[model samples]
Structures are given as structure tokens and as C-alpha cells.
Target: MPDCSRPNRINIDLGPYKQRWVAYCALHQLTPSAAFRQVVAKLTENMATAGDAAAAPPTTRKHRKEIGLTDAELRFVEACAEAEGFSPTRWIIALIQARMGNGAQFGQFELAALGKSNLILLTIARQLRQIAGMQQGLAGGPMPELLPVVAEVRTRIANHTAEVAQAIARNIERWHGK
Candidate 1:
């Protein structure tokens, strides 16, 4: 085999444990070069340990209390949680975190966006109905000439709905990653 020993000419500072290092090498049946390699391996392992320590999850404390809710409201909360695929407690925790402006919270932004998008769709639908009525008045005919306008409005609604769906997908993906 090729030489596995490290060069002894290299200078190293053993600090206060220099004598202990010599004894440890003798006890472990290691040459000076092998002892140095072992020390380096230990140091590398400790560096990895420090990195793991830094990445450790933050601590959390939970305090629970009983809160009275009307039966109807409790049922509604449960229903909402079921629809969202979350436990009622987790859903409530998400809500509280959202209200507290915690970035780690889930669903709040997407929920708000979905609500707003639905409202916009409703408004667009209402406008289309109003325009159809106006076209009927203008043309004074059985079938209003507003068919094209109605078609255009329908297309816009579809586009808006698709956009909202895409946004929801993205939000869901982000939540899953979290």
C-alpha cells in the first residue's frame, strides 16, 4: 500500500492537552500521523454537529383553554375545517397566526385572494346581465344583438376564474412545501 502517514514536518499547536494527546495516541495504537488524522476527523464531526444545532427547530409552548361557543358556530367551524382538510384546532391556529401577521401561517393570503376574486367574478356577472338588459332596450327585438357582448363577458369570466385557480394551485404548492 502507498504511504498513509501524514508528514511530521508540519507544525501544529496542541494547546494545553499536548501531553494527553501523546498518551491518547499510545493507548489507541496510533502513530503521530494517525493521531493527527483522528483529531481532524473529530474536529470535522464537531463542525457538522454545530451546523445541526443551528438548524434545530425553534421551541414552542402550548397553553390551552376552554372557550364557550354556540352550537351552531361550533358546527360551522368544524365544517369549515373539514372543507379545508385541517383539524379545527389547526385551522383556528392558522387564523390566529394570520391575524398576528406571522409569515409561517397558512391559507390566509390565498383565502383572501379567493374571496376577492369571487367578488370580482360576481360583479362581472352582474355587469354582463345589466348590459344584456340594456341591449334589449336599445334593439327592441326578441333576441338582443348583445350576444357577442355576452360571449365576450363569459370568456373574460372564464379567464379570471382560471387565473384564480392557478393562484390557488401555487398557494397550495407553497403550503405543502412548508
Candidate 2:
């Protein structure tokens, strides 16, 4: 008889998609086993969220799974999650959900804020370019007319630069492992 303590291995036949699946795994730098596990995990997570009766059992903890982690890795996860005001399990779930889905690791608000920052920077650059063109096309010692625009751009760049840095730091802290 087979040992019950050991995990059972199963073979999957991908048929025509076998090459495509292998290529995807290679591109993502994941082994076939890891990719398969992720796909199954994501499917189960979705089913659980959808309240599929067959996918969930009464005796089982719906949201818990024992992912093998070394002692040091577990400690690191705990520490990182604690710093981010989440339990290690919650952190891991969030990471997996974000990384596995077609979404960015950043929260919606965080992504929006970053997008707004990029737009502001682009506008500032355009304003500066316009001012430079005006200066170059016409001979002028100083353009007092554009001083207000320059000042505004300088202020915005300074403010938005700081905000972008903070956002980047927060995102890196939240998704460091990913």
C-alpha cells in the first residue's frame, strides 16, 4: 500500500495546448508543478467566493490551506504581514490573488493615484517645453510672463514627486515578495 503521509502525484495531458502551457510556464519562470498548483488554487478561490456548495465542505476551513514554508520563510512572512497590518495568511492570499489575476499588485486607489501622478508630471513637462520653445523662438533676457507657469510646475513637480515616492514605497512594501 502507498504511504498516506506522502502527496499523490497526478499526470495531466494538455493535448494541443501542451506546448502553449509549457511556454507560459517558462515565460513566467514557473515550473509545471508550480503553475498547475497556482491554476488550481485560483480556481478554488473563485469557486469558494462564488459560494459553490460542491467546492466547499462543512468540515473544512474554507479559507485555510497549509502551504509548505520553511521556518525562516514563515517568520519573514509573519513579520512582513504584521508590518502591513495583515495576518500572514491574509497577506499570502492577497498576494496570490493579485499576482494570479489580470490586475496590478497595487490597490485600486493606489493605482489611480499613480496614474494621476504620471499625468501631472507629463503636464509639467509639456509646460516646461512650451516655455523653453517660447524662450528659444524669441530673443528675451527673461520671460516674466511665464514665471507663474514655471513656479506652478516647480511646485507641482516637488509635491507630486514626494507623493509618487511614497506610493512606490508602499507598493514595494506590500508586494515585495511578488
My TM-score estimates for the predictions, one after another, are 0.32, 0.42
lDDT of 1 by residue, 1-178 (tens): 4345854455678899888888988999998778887767786775667677545555587888777889998997788666665587887776666555454343545566677787878878787788867766874565555676677788878888887877666545444444
CA lDDT, every prediction? 0.70, 0.77
TM accuracy, model 1: 0.32
Candidate number with greatest lDDT:
2
C-alpha RMSD for every candidate: 17.1, 14.6
Compute the lDDT of residue 6 as modeled in candidate 1. Answer: 57
Model 2 residue runs over 4 Å out of place are 1-91, 94-104, 175-178
Tens digit per residue, CA lDDT, model 2, 1-178 = 5556766665778899999999999999999989998988886986777667647665545655677999999999888677655677767777886676523255555657878987997998899998888788667567777789888988999999899888777866566553
Note the residue pairs that clash in candidate 1.
none
